[model samples]
Target: MNADLSRLANYLNPDKKKLAAKGITSVRSRVANLTELLPGITHEQVCQAVTEAFFAHYGERVDAEVISPDKTPDLPNFAETFARQSSWEWNFGQAPAFSHLLDERFTWGGVELHFDVEKGVITRAQAFTDSLNPAPLEALAERLQGCCTARINYRKRAKRC
Candidate 1:
C-alpha cells in the first residue's frame, strides 16, 4: 500500500521540518509488512531493489557509474583526514550551550551539581549540598571550570574531583 511519505516523515520526526526549511529534500518512509511477508530476504536483495527503484524513477536524469570492488581508492592524507574528522573539536565543539545536572546522595548528605557547558567545555559549575561542611563541594565546582566535558577528559578529572 502506498502512503503519503511527506506526511509520514512529519509524523515520524518533526525535526525533518527544519530540513525542508533549509531547502534539503528528504526521502523518508518505511515499509511495514514487507519483512513480515518475506522474512528470509537478504541485505543485498534489499539494496538491489532500492537501487532499481531509484534508477527507474530518476531514469535518464541521473548518470550511472561504477568503481570496481577490488580497486583501492588512493587517499594520500588519510591519517590527517581521519585525525581531523575524529577529533573532539570537529565533533562536539560546535554544539550549542547547554546545562547538565547530576544529583547524588551520600552517607553524609545529598549533593546536586549543575554544569553550564559551551564549546564542549564546562564554562561554569555550581554545587548544592545539605552537608554541614561544603568546602569539598565548592572546591570540586571550582576545579570543574575550563575542564573539557568529553568522556575521556571528564572521567580523568572526575576521578580527581
Candidate 2:
C-alpha cells in the first residue's frame, strides 16, 4: 500500500548514487502512505532535512530564501484590461537574437510586425484594413520597417494612417 518514496527521491535528486548510499533505499516499505507521514512532519523540518541531504550528497551548501505570502506583490489584472479593449487583440513572441513577431488586430484593421531582434530593427510589416483603398496601410507598413517598436509614437503614427 506504500509508495516507493526512495525511487521518488532518487528521481527528484540530481545525484542518485549518493542518495542510495544514505539509508533511504526503500523509504520504509511498511509506512502505508504519505498522509501518515505528513502529521509528524513540519515544513521547516522537511526543508532542513532536504538541505542536509543535499549537502551530504553533493558536499556543497544550499541556500534557500523563505518569503511570506503577504510580502509578494499583486499581479496585474490582464484579463480585465483585455476584455475592455474591444477594438484590438494582440499577441507577441520573443527570444534572444532571433526573429520576433508582434501581431495586432483592430476591429476594422490589423497589423503584423516582424523584427530582426539581433540587428535591432523591424524586418517587415504588413497591415490589413476593411477600407477598399489598402495603399495607405501598405505604405505605412513599408515605412515602418527599420524602425524600433520602443521608439514608435503610436498616436502620431495613427494620425498619418
Candidate 3:
C-alpha cells in the first residue's frame, strides 16, 4: 500500500489506541480481520472513497493549526548525541558494524537523553529531566528508539516534540 493510504488506514482505525492500551495479543483477532479487509481496498480509487467517507463522518473534529515559523520548537541536539558515542564493531560481516552511545543534555529544556545504538538502531533509550513531570521527555525518548538517524525528517518531527 502507498504511504498516504497506510496513513489513512492508521487514522481511520480506532484499534491504534486500543493496541497501545492493550497488548498486541489482545487485538490480534480484530487486527487479522482488518488485515484481510485492508488489501482489497488499498487501491487509489478505494483510498479516495475511504478518505471521503472519513471526512464526511469526522470532518468537524479535524483541526488544522498554522503555526508561524518563528514559533517553531528548537531542533534537538542530535550532533552532541551522535558525537559522544564510542564506535565498535557490532558483528563480523561485509557490512560495516558500528555502535553508538549517546548522552545529550538540552540546556534550554533541562532534558537529557542516554541512548544506546547498535547497527544504526537505538537499542536502549533513557530520558531525564529536572522537572517533576517527565512524561514529555520520556515520550520523546521512546519515539526516538528504533528511528533511523539518516531517515528522520528533523524539521517535520521537531514541531511535534
TM-score for each prediction? 0.50, 0.32, 0.33
Instruction: Write model 2 residue lDDT over 38-66, tens digit each, in one string.
Output: 66666667668879998899998757654
Residue pairs in collision within model 3: none
Point to the candidate with the largest lDDT. Answer: 1
Q: Is candidate 2 or candidate 3 better by TM-score?
A: 3
Q: Count clashing pairs, candidate 2.
A: 0
Which residue ranges in model 2 land beyond 4 Å of their true spot? 1-95, 109-111, 129-131
Give model 3's TM-score versus the native structure: 0.33
Count of backbone clashes for each model? 0, 0, 0
Which of candidates 1 and 3 is the stronger one according to lDDT? 1
Q: Tell me model 3's lDDT, rounded to 2 decimals.
A: 0.56
lDDT score for candidate 1 against the true structure: 0.75
Of the pair 1 and 2, which is ahead by lDDT? Answer: 1
